[model samples]
Target chain A: MPFTMTAAALKIDHLGKRFGATAAVDDLSLEIAPGEIFGLLGPNGAGKSTTINMITGVTRPQTGSVSVFGYDNRRQALIARRLVGVMHQEIVIDHFFTVRQAIRIHVGYYGLPDDPGWRATLIERLGLGPHLAKPLRELSGGMKRRFMIAKAMIHKPRLLILDEPTAGVDIELRRSLWEFVREINGQGTTVLLTTHYLEEAEKMCGRIAIMNRGRLVALEGKETLLNRLGGRRLIVTLAQPLATLPAALAEDRSLLSWDPDHLTFAVAGPGAVGERLRRLALGGLHIADLDMRKPDLEEVFLQLTGNGNHHPAAEP
Target chain B: MTGPLPLPPFQPWLPFLTLLKREVLRFLRVSFQTLLAPVITASLYLFVFGATLGQRISVLEGFSYAQFVIPGLILMGIINNSFANTSTSLFMSRYLGNIVDLLVAPITAPQLILAYTLAAMLRGMLVGAVITLIALGFAPLPWVYPGLGLVMALLSSFLFAQFGLIAAIHANTFDALSMFTNFLLLPLIYFGGVFYPVSILPPFWEGLSRCNPLFYLIDGFRFALLGSGDNPFWLSFGISAAMAGGLFLWAALLIATGYRLRN
Candidate 1:
């Protein structure tokens, strides 16, 4: 089938995978266009990694097919693989080799002839010049992630697949790395990324697909997905502890919470905040502080995943 | 209007060569452990067995017992080194998560199998040659047919290398690979009549030894070295070649399917 956009980078059709008795990836389909940064947001075991593996030809799907830039992944695996580059979630490097040597070896595998200029440019672009001579074991977790990105981009592939690229990276480093990725995407390379940080996906990706229990639960534009969890929240800090909810605030009781020292209530619809304040004022309750909160990707993710437990420690 | 295609078709060999080069460089960088250690160990076996026990036995035909065990020592090195090289390399790649890099690359499965197997073969030959040279230091045996010996050594190395790759793919842990080597490969090498001629065994035991592929490999090399073997050289060569071909096809198929490499 012809894609909505002429330059389709990847197309996965009705893909399914099972590991013994457990279903790892269900009958899922997705499409990525050239020059687009598509985000795959999901909790652990959501089949995000499985999907990437299927697309990269690392794992064969039990049922269905995948195509890279229109080439069938199974029939024309070599052609498909050549067009795609992947940076895996785990940090893997040869501890003995220097960064320069490691990249050189990787570049050699793709059979690129010695191009000093391109190598130098990559080193500088990735901020790896200072660590070129340092052994991989000496580099921190963030540096290794960046090194993986540079290694994946060495062949100048048309599509780049990054699985949890910023899992342990610091905030500043993550932003800079995203900026670098944006620069690469601007040059027309399609990027498919899976991340746990919902904010990162909301900021970087125009389109997103959320996988849950090996199934695609939601797939749409970032805004469209966020809109699924309607309305906003208003958290009000009270001047004094309130013993009980006043009669005027009974209608919005579901959204209201009696904080030990601060009163926080969620507003379900537009202009509910004003009405809540009016009710509180009429009840003679004084507000010490008021804060407005919008529905971000995290809320939408929790709503869709349906597991209110937001424990980051459980993530892989 | 449609525009012409901007980029030319990419060359396929680039990724294959890249993987091959990496495999070669990995083993080559650690020649002391991978190359020299095997050579020294094989020589020790030759010295203790060929010099001590060989002297007690009467010379077979015109050749001495020391000369008789040379081919066995060399073949033993080929079998062990070839298996170790591929298995260790693949196991490390899997454990370190670098295999994903190759999995995601544009190279075909057959190419990957060939490249990895060839690197193992190179290591096998290097170790085998060192053992041969060490054997010569004790007893100088002329190669009855240098061409035949070279071909047999390479075929044996290729077969064992493919076996190693298969074992590595199936193995979930390093201990699993070690179990196969210690339990299967080690016993087979010792029982393959590498130390003594298979003629002295009981009828059933001798018959059983013939079933071991390593026997054909060692016997074929012995024939090439001393112009004498327990079985006809051509029969041994045919069996080894067929086994190697079958294993190569199986390895290629496993890699093509992504087997255990995929999640």
Candidate 2:
């Protein structure tokens, strides 16, 4: 088969995977364009990892087809795999080899000769210079993740796939890592990332696909996704406790919450924020402190997945 | 800052060689377990079996008992090491999930299989050579056809390595791998007449030994080393080569299907 460069770096069509009786990935399809960062956002067991496995040739989907850079993944796996690089969800490494040695071995697997120049560039890019000589066993959780990203980039693949790359990383490290990812994408490397950090997706991905129960429930631009979830919020905290909602504000009760001294409400849209404040003042509820939380990715994600459970901590 | 950089030129064989080197280095890094231990074990077998059995049985057609068993001992070492290397490497990679790195690479299944099996064969040959050298301490080992012995050893090593890879793919746990080694490999090697000729067995058992592929491998190596094999040299060579070919094809098929490598 001949090779051609195209606008879409990856095109997954009607992909589905079944493990005996359970369907792990169901009828998933998406198109990732070159130079674009795409996010696969979903909860655990939502088939995010399974979809990645299919795209990278680590696992075959029982039904449907995947094409990478115009090469069919199942039919031209070698070529497809050549164009893609994957950083798996698990932080697995050969404990025996130092970071430099591991990077060398990974580069070799792609049949690329060791280039000290390229290694140095990656070391600087991923902030791994200090840990170059350290074995994987000796590295901290965040450092190990950085090393994995560096390893994936060793071959300079056209398409990069990251499955939960920041699972155990700290906040500062994640910010820097996302910056590096942005730098790579700026250089025209297509990135397909699966992350639990909804904010990361909103910041990095041009397009996001939300998966749930082995199904692709939502796929759209970040702004469009948030718009679909409706509007922002206006939170009010009072100095005195309130036993019940004032009768005049009864119509907004579904969108409002009341505690002894704290009151919160979901503002329906831009116009609703003004009306909500006017009604609040009319009810004579004196606010001690008021905060308006913007409609962030977390709210959008919760509305789409229909689960209000907050992540214990934001993933790095 | 501007446009995307073009990918560097592709070098097809470079990755295969690198993976092969990694496999070799992995086994060599633990030479005490992969090489020296096998050699010592073979030597002990030679000392005990050759010394005790030679007193009862006359030298088998011009070769001493110690000399007669050397080929079988080397072949045995080759089989064990080859199988062990491939199976353990693959199983460990799978268990640790590092195999995903190989699977996602641009490398083909055939290249992956060849790199791994070739590494296993190299280790098997190294172990076999060490055992042959160790056997020299007990008695002077002669090779009627040094070239033929080398060829037989290599072919047998490749065969066993392929078998071990296939077993690794099918196995889910370490116990499954161990079961095949202990219940199948050990029995087949011993019953295939490594120490004694199959002609001394009951007619029924002798017929069964002919069916064991390892028997043909040992017979071919023994023919090259002693020139007094139980079967004709051509017959042993033909059977062993055919067995190797079948295993190679099966391994290729398994990898192509992405059998256990896929979810």
DockQ winner among the candidates? Answer: 2
Per residue, candidate 2 scores C-alpha lDDT tens digits across B53-112 of 744564477777777787899999999999999999998888887888888887777889
Q: Candidate 1, which segments miss by more than 4 Å at Cα?
A: A1-5, A20-22, A253-258, A261-271, A308-316, B1-9, B50-56
Please give each candidate's TM-score. 0.91, 0.92
Error of 1 at B84 (Å): 0.7
Give DockQ per model, in order.
0.43, 0.47
| Residue pairs whose backbone atoms clash in candidate 1 | A82-B106, A109-B18
- lDDT comparing candidate 1 with the true structure: 0.81
lDDT for residue A149 in candidate 1, whole number 0-100: 82
lDDT of 1 by residue, A1-316 (tens): 2223444688889999999988889999988777789999888998898888888877778998998777887887766776778898889887657898888877656556656887887788778899998988899988998899888888777788989998898887787789878988887778998888888898999999989989998899988886665555578888888887778765554343465466556566556777788888998899888987776888778867876532221100
Q: Compared with the true structure, what per-residue lDDT tens digits does model 1 show for residues B29-66?
A: 78898888998899788888677876666445677788
Error of 1 at A261 (Å): 4.4
